[model samples]
Target: MPANKLAVVTGASTGIGLELARCCAEDGFDLVIAANEPAIEAAAAELRKIGGSVVAVQADLATTEGVDKLYAAVGDRPIDALLANAGVGLGNAFLGQDFGRVRRVVDTNITGTLYLIHRVGNEMLRRNSGRILITGSVAGFTPGSFQAVYNGTKAFLDSFSFALREELRDSGVTVTCLMPGATETEFFRRADMMDTKVGTDKKDDPHEVAKAGFDAMLRGDSDIVTGVKNKLQTTVANVTPNEVLAKQHRKMAEPGTAKP
Candidate 1:
């Protein structure tokens, strides 16, 4: 990577996205990091300590207007890499979840994601050089049961990443998807999933997951699942019947399943 290259990472206030931004800063890339909360500024401060220019943008990635704000933050600078990692998760039976929360999940995970990719991806194509790392999930491979909306959105992202990769295969740009299993993040609490088995279960380390993803993106690999267990889960999911998968997911995701 060039010493002066610029990378834009969304969902960068905490967890995987923040770690990804740290990786970029360490690699000598100037960064434009964004999240929907004010905490993004604090994350930027930390990234700056890694010795690269860091610009923080706080915008709701669930809306086109917010996406545009992030894009505008990049100004006329060429984007050498883009990490589209903004997403939301909702737990509980799909029908029982609030409609507004469900829409937010869909908008953030799918609509805003695609819109940003469409705009930034085109610019990368015109420049004929760039890399994209999309945060997909192993959850996409199975029926989510209680996490229906979240998993459905991830399914779309997983598929979309591959299709986009093929479309840009001949271009200088490359796309990589990081399909990590659950990790140590604020995700469970935010999603109201703390009472579920999966929420209470041991998870991959955020730093390790981020490193794996950043490495894959740098290598231009098509995709990567961060851990051994996650890889096995994906393999099993591929052959399992949907009905079985749904039942299995229920054991892990159903509310009130956490141990006392």
Candidate 2:
């Protein structure tokens, strides 16, 4: 509610992360934004024009060094919100995929995000105030064939957010998970999935998904699925057998599956 509460958004270089940073700035939050790309400087400058303090940290989020860079940017600021939205999407047939790339995905999406959450959440707990919004994906609920690594990383994030939310109940620190379905983002292009059905298809807007998470975090909801279609898919996946869900997912995510 303050005019200059501090908000830190990771993966703030592009896509959903960029939108989150913009939303926070509009809502009057001084921002500590981190991203791997050199372009984040432009994004930070744009936000600064909106009348909020802005600090941009450029670091590769797939390693400890990058996470440390992000923390160092925040320094001792008492953050009011933390948006752990940095992530990567990698799609490749399991057997033929590059193992190193798979590790990078896991490192960035799961390990790096969690490390930031741990540091920020502790500070939030100590201050007895803060909100955390994590970006998860609908892909987490099903077994993705070609996008296996990305999906698994999201599964960890979604599950971790739920558990963390419960643990932080009554602590004045809120944790919210934003599980978005297919969304138009640079993610697929970066992941080399531009030719896939899930990649090239019409998708939800990243701004919409960011707004959903922003609003939900303010409301202190534990988790939210952004789209109606994604809500239904989440419900069905919850009740369906894993095998059947995996088969369905494979149709959309596998590199060699035949479409009807």
Candidate 3:
């Protein structure tokens, strides 16, 4: 809300993360953006043109070292907002996928994410002023038959975000969760799901999703699902049986389900 507020956005190389950073830039917040790829530098360059300082950190945020590196970049500077949107997804049966890849997904989506939150969160609490936005997913509600590990990690994030919100309820800080359905992003491609129906299906726009998230975070709402369809999907998931959900997911995410 001030001229020099700082916002930190992770997984900011592209997609929803990049859009989120753009939102911060447009809102007049200097930014610290991170991604494991070198592309982060390019993203920073793009944001700088919009006005305000933009620092990019190319660190493997799935590791403790990486999280520490990003935090060090902040170096005692007060973070007005922290957008924890760094995460990865993996597709296919858990037993058949590479274990290393699966581990990376877990580490990136949960371990490192929580580590960063713990660090920034304490500072926010100490000052009693800050906003935290966690990028969770509606996929968390179902048993992802083909995307087992990725979905499991999201489930953790969705639940964790709420519990943390409650703990910090009376404080000057607020935590919001952005739960979006499939969107136009590199996610499905990176997950090697190009052949799946969900991967190829028309989805929500990243800019819209990011705007909804950024607005909700500023408003300190509990959570937001980006699209009308997604809102309905998650609501139905709440009542659907896990067995049924898993079957439905298989239809969308199973390998080679993409229409020919």
Candidate 4:
């Protein structure tokens, strides 16, 4: 029998990453999933229950060494898909936040992410085939008040995804950006956004968001913002003044803005 297609998913321990992995598994792709936490092993086990091969790697995706470790785990297999979904978030005034935490967010969301994509994306280019799905956010379109750095990183990814797709247009490889809005994930708590109105508000389900992204990647779509509300938000952001947008964001993201 022929081997199944292989997919590598980062941040697969929870949320959208895990759901993306699930989508891959269900679609008959064997998976190599990585995360910065030991929960990855548990996630791997769950994926195995659905059948096909699953290798879980626990490594911090915030550093070169960690991305190297995850890359090493996929040594011989030609990757059919690469889901660059690992990222960190920070919620609070930029000046008041710890520099170390801020740096970690940037490193994970931008530096490390780019390093991994450059490595894996090049391989895909050589083969002239592969799918790359990057998890960006509609937040990229806004000036996030308390979540400035996180949104900034996503904006970079959103722009980068489209640019790379155009550069590789003739190649069989395709790059897609998955721009979801606030999701019901550990992101809010981890980012210290629990006190904000946006964090407390109802959020999109990660599974549905991932499904949209995974399907778009298979279809070679350039980008997808998963929810109707988010699509509207992005549309408005396009024409809104930056100053006004920033103020609106502050209302939703500022600390102590959560409703009773």
Instruction: Score every model by TM-score.
Output: 0.99, 0.95, 0.99, 0.99
Q: What lDDT tens digits, residue by residue, belong to model 1 across residues 94-159?
A: 889899999999999999999999999999999999999999999999989999999999999999
Q: Rate the local accuracy (lDDT) of all candidates.
A: 0.96, 0.88, 0.96, 0.96
Return the clash pairs for model 1, or none.
none
Task: Give the candidate number with the greatest TM-score.
Answer: 4
- The residue ranges of model 4 lying beyond 4 angstroms of the native Cα positions read none
Candidate 1: misplaced stretches above 4 Å?
1-3
What number of backbone clashes does candidate 1 have, counting pairs of residues 3 or more apart or in separate chains? 0
Give the total clashing residue pairs for model 2. Answer: 0
- Superposed on all Cα atoms, the candidates' RMSDs to the truth, in angstroms, are 1.2, 1.9, 1.1, 0.5
Residues 10-113 of candidate 3 have per-residue lDDT tens digits of: 99999999999999999999999999999999999999999999999999999999999999998778999999999999998889999999999999999999
Q: Tell me which residue pairs clash in candidate 4.
A: none
**94-192 per-residue lDDT for model 2 (tens digits):** 678888988889999988988888888898999899999999988889888788778888998899999999999989999999999988888888888
